[model samples]
Target: MADLRDVAMDSKAWPFQEARALAKRYEKAPPEKGHVLFETGYGPSGLPHIGTFGEVLRTTMIRRAFELISDIPTRLICFSDDLDGMRKVPDNVPDQAMLRENLQRPLTSVPDPFGEFESFGHHNNAMLRRFLDTFGFEYEFISATEFYASGRFDETLREAARKYDDVMKIMLASLREERQQTYSCFLPIHPETGRVLYVPMKEVNAEDGTITFDDEDGREWTLPVTGGHVKLQWKPDFGARWAALGVDFEMYGKDHSTNTPIYDGICEVLGGRAPHHFTYELFLDETGQKISKSKGNGLTIDEWLTYASTESLSYFMYQKPKTAKRLHFDVIPKAVDEYHQQIRGFKGQEPVQQLANPAWHIHGGQVPESDLVVPFSMLLNLASVAGAEDKATLWGFIRRYAPDATPKSHPGLDAAVGHAVRYYNDRVKPHKTYRMPDVSERAAMEEVLAALDEWQGEADAEALQNMLYAIGKEHRFDPLRHWFQALYEVLLGASEGPRFGGFIALYGIEETKALIVKALRGDLAHEEPIDI
Candidate 1:
């Protein structure tokens, strides 16, 4: 893990600067703990991918940290903009048909195509909340539909339009001249029932900045505007909502960072104060033209949790939310284990590093460890497997042998499980898997097996390992890797796998021999196995 000092030394402070700059623009002081109101927002992608927690959890962490530092009270509220229209139905979401059908309707209004639950947006929000709760984050989730109906956004919208009218008009004029915008007017005409299409405002003052649009037509209606209609449009409506809500801090991904300035501008015009602090996160799996959904790829928070802890997931959020980083599944487990390491060191549970690295403590929990997992311990287990079995077999063997009989399992138990599973999934194929060797490769295999037999009852991992290597050398195989391949060919029918020495210790000699014998006879056949 990188030390906090080194991370700060190498880090770009652009995000921090932007956050601070916004606060300064608002003329607000740096927030004190327990006294400041922090507003975090999220887009309901529905069935939130890991990135959703990455955005909210980090904000929640920072909010907690800030509260601990001072008397400033803090609250974490996740604003789900389900009100926005559907841009694209995520590949995993059911009802791809709705993506086309609900073109102009509000996203919140769209029915969930799947029989899962409520609307699609609500389903996704529930998933995100589940992930967060697993990590112990306490955030109040607010939906756009609810917030708008409760009158929380009305003041901000009215005030912002009145206050920033000049600025917005100029901005909109420029945007339209660039052929980038459209404006419309609301014309309340009677729909088939003789009721007005829109109930006109009970009273309004367009010239004086006092416009009241209420329910007069027995249905809610947004106020009309100008040579064109002026109700807050889709994007700008969010900014108005934010300003009214007094959102002190919010974060977004790189995808939204570009046009967010427009949101800020709209908030300014609407009278509600825009969020002063914000973080822009990078993309996940955006680089690939094809992202995997079956294997838990491309924005499923559930998949990330399968491999990474909530804190590590939070740590991913803290790093500069840039567009360049790719949070691959392959790299997540180690990252999570590293977070546990940091949690230990920062809280004095573990020994300090021999060298300096980036780490910090806030609200009693240490900032999650460095982004780089380095040569971590749990990973060493996977890296060590010598084709003894696929990750599942290896794991089952370990559990059977070592068993978490003690009150506690090893420090990185979850991470180990994750690594083993992922490794097994990626490398071990039922058919066409890389086998240790065949009978034709026996001369070599026997040599390594003999070493194993000789090393029997050698309880010490290191000593048994050395004996295996010595045997491999006499057989013309690299002594350093002597028994490793032989073990794989005999046990798993593969030339390599997660650590061999550890497996021998974890699985016990009897189990190891049995696995080897099974592979040697080609008894195991190819079939796609289910996760254990």
Candidate 2:
């Protein structure tokens, strides 16, 4: 392992470099206190989803990088905005009528549809914490409801109340004319109806820290600024949290970039500087629409974990956080394969180069030692072809390739076999398309089948790859790339697959030869490739 000091000083990994720069900037002009704080917020309107996982995972990577560069005391606050009003009921949860009845009420005041917690907000908050715990995240969980109820935000609340006109001016500049008439920086909870009201305030007394507003019942009411009587609007709330907690760093989605300046202005007006801001691109679904928890369009965290390892999910987040990427089931196999490749290559790289690799951050700067055996994608294909239902079936093929390998000694591969089994059953089985080889492709396949016997089952992937390419050239397949495509179409019934050499090595030369023979005999032939 390389010294972290060397890596931290010169590493070009974006997250590490970003963390190092942030630390230096903050150290020159430390915050109100000596500590550095990072904050990630979650709106607990629904269960913790994949987007939630990405936010926390990316934040944790930055935190890890920051720790390597600076010895300053640091903390990450996973804040849940549970005090937000329930505008609409989530379609996924039970008891929709109950939630609909509580619309306009604070989330904490709504009854839990699941009946597992005191309130809907509490249940959701608990789910978020549980999800974070599963990833071994180190953070303090803060609830907006608790913070407001405990009077921890009293000072910030009072400050917002005093600067109400200033905050409103900044917020209203971004709103439409019709919205400006009803917008207020402070949303007071109506004492009579127990509903969070968003109407215009009649009067704001800076000296008394109270706001006078009219309720839905046409009654004028004055509420105290503290003790949970009022909650700031979202933009103002973001500022208040930054000031109150002295947050040093936070990242948000690009969709919020337009409003970030307003948040900064509000924080400055409240006598606090906004945290260092990093805006990341949003995660989109297969249709290229933004992933919405309310819409349930994207893959859930549970779905991701079911098909891939957590470390693979972390690797997906590690790759270019600022770039937009579509996240769906189709991404899991590639992500898993990429994670394996990184881990296999970790030990051979130069120390500085290793520092730039995602596996370093994914594994918290400590890369584990492991021999390359088989890729997860290959395992999925093997499981599909073999109809494997358990570890024993996949391990049977693995042992034939690597005779010494054991399930007990190779837990990662073992676990991948299980994930691949489920992934194949759920995603690949229904969509499989096997194409019969054309006249030229059959000639190439015959050459490949003959060459397998000469392999002796001992050549490495590179050697076998060269042999396959030579066979493709010998058979004169147009463009040459079609050789491998022919192999995939014949053996796996897919137009693309794992590296042929690697797949043959793991699936065994004898078995691979038989499968090709079977394909040549038309046992695996299907309709021609669809013209997509």
Candidate 3:
């Protein structure tokens, strides 16, 4: 076992630093049975979304970090709060009428809208598992329904029941005046109706860990805490789960930050210590509105993977999770590019520095040594300019630029090219507006074309970039500001684009001259030049 102090002092990775702190905390007071448990929670009310993936992915990264510094047995439990009642039908699911009929019933008991699984919760749980499995996440999945029904929560339930009054006080203090009138920490499942009822317990016997509550029909019933007849409200449930599982660490969104103290208090009252808590800012839509599962308004896991690699998505989550970030289609290209940049940066770094690189955490310390043949954004531009749809056409340009490269050797680039072509056709091409270069711009582009045509030797992106800058300065176009814009306007019809030097080199000098000739001839011209 590595000395945690030595490990802490050895690495600069934030995840490792957090791991060291957790290790020290655990050493001060080890958990029961000498195991460290990390937990990530999900609500099976709807299909697993990108936010769900983010929580688990981030937790898994922390878990990986902990393993590097400690020899203690570690476990990551991906728990689904499936026992929760279905308060309302999800907007994205089918068979709305059937779901509406099952409202207020435990999600595990509600009929599956898709009719594939036994219940709504089961269907969603399966979807969640499938999504996680797609990314090859390493964790054990525990369903709340099974955990509660199988008596895994028996001890915790009894403790919660014994601390019922204390828990009530903690919950009611946080609720509004109107809500306190009917609020109870324990909600009993009606024996007959099977619906989870929110009415206050009519009588409580702490000694026996049992409660008496009336159903909606006014029939009084008594149930023991050992059975799955009662469940704690969400806030209490959060605390109870921490105590039950002996969780050492967990992370949730910022929306739950305010309730964290209350949950910690509830855990303390229940004779358990609070786990380490991390609250990340919420993911917002492109419009800067909160992305909600019920509203179904943001990019989903499937939607992201459809156009980008899983590593790219992981990299997106790896960045400053505590700060709010926008997750939308528009951000995908940048994420892809950043992922490549990290991969490239990882290759040249020393061992200690590489350990601290984001790619180290992003790939769980197995950073791949591979060259980025082309940036994804560059591929998008290449696809747009050349009208390339398949890998053959894209690879044609790649081979021309780098004769040593092949589609077989650069699978990442190949796959990205396919996605870029589809993305360009679907998202970028429709609203694309090409701007015609004015007279001065035309003369400058012609000069660039003539220079490229006369050049015979190999021209790298740096040389080409320098030449473009010199041309811009010679033509009084201000190379620092507007030189790239002229090339973009004439070639790709956008104000901004990939580095023109790299794009020109990758697209080949002959193709570049031809594109310039077309632009000068007004064949690719727009109605008017767009002002920057």
Best by TM-score: 2
TM-score of each: 0.67, 0.95, 0.94
lDDT of each: 0.51, 0.85, 0.83
Candidate 2 C-alpha lDDT tens digits along 237-271: 99889988888888999998988898898889999
The digit string of per-residue lDDT tens for model 1 on 1-532 reads: 2353344233233332343343344345544332345666666654565666666655664554343333345677877776555655666665678666764334555677776757766776676677778877777888876665566655554464455445455346536554333231122222232222223334444545443444443554444332112334556656766666666677665666666777777666655556754546455474653233223466466556555555556555555554445766655655655555555566443322311212342223344433222223333333333332334444554455455522134434535455545544543433324253555356655554555566645455566566566555665564455456556544554555445665566656655555545455454433222122
Candidate order, TM-score descending: 2, 3, 1
Number of colliding residue pairs in model 1: 46
Worst 10 residues of 3 by lDDT: 523-532
Q: Superposing all C-alpha atoms, what RMSD in Å does each candidate have to the true structure?
A: 7.5, 3.1, 3.0
Pick the winner on TM-score between candidates 2 and 3: 2
Model 2, C-alpha of 175: deviation from truth (Å)? 1.5
- Clash totals for all candidate models: 46, 0, 0
lDDT of 2 at 138: 92
The superposed Cα distance between candidate 3 and the true structure at residue 372, in angstroms, equals 2.7
**Which 10 residues in a row give candidate 1 its minimum summed lDDT?**
182-191
**Candidate 3: misplaced stretches above 4 Å?**
1-12, 525-532
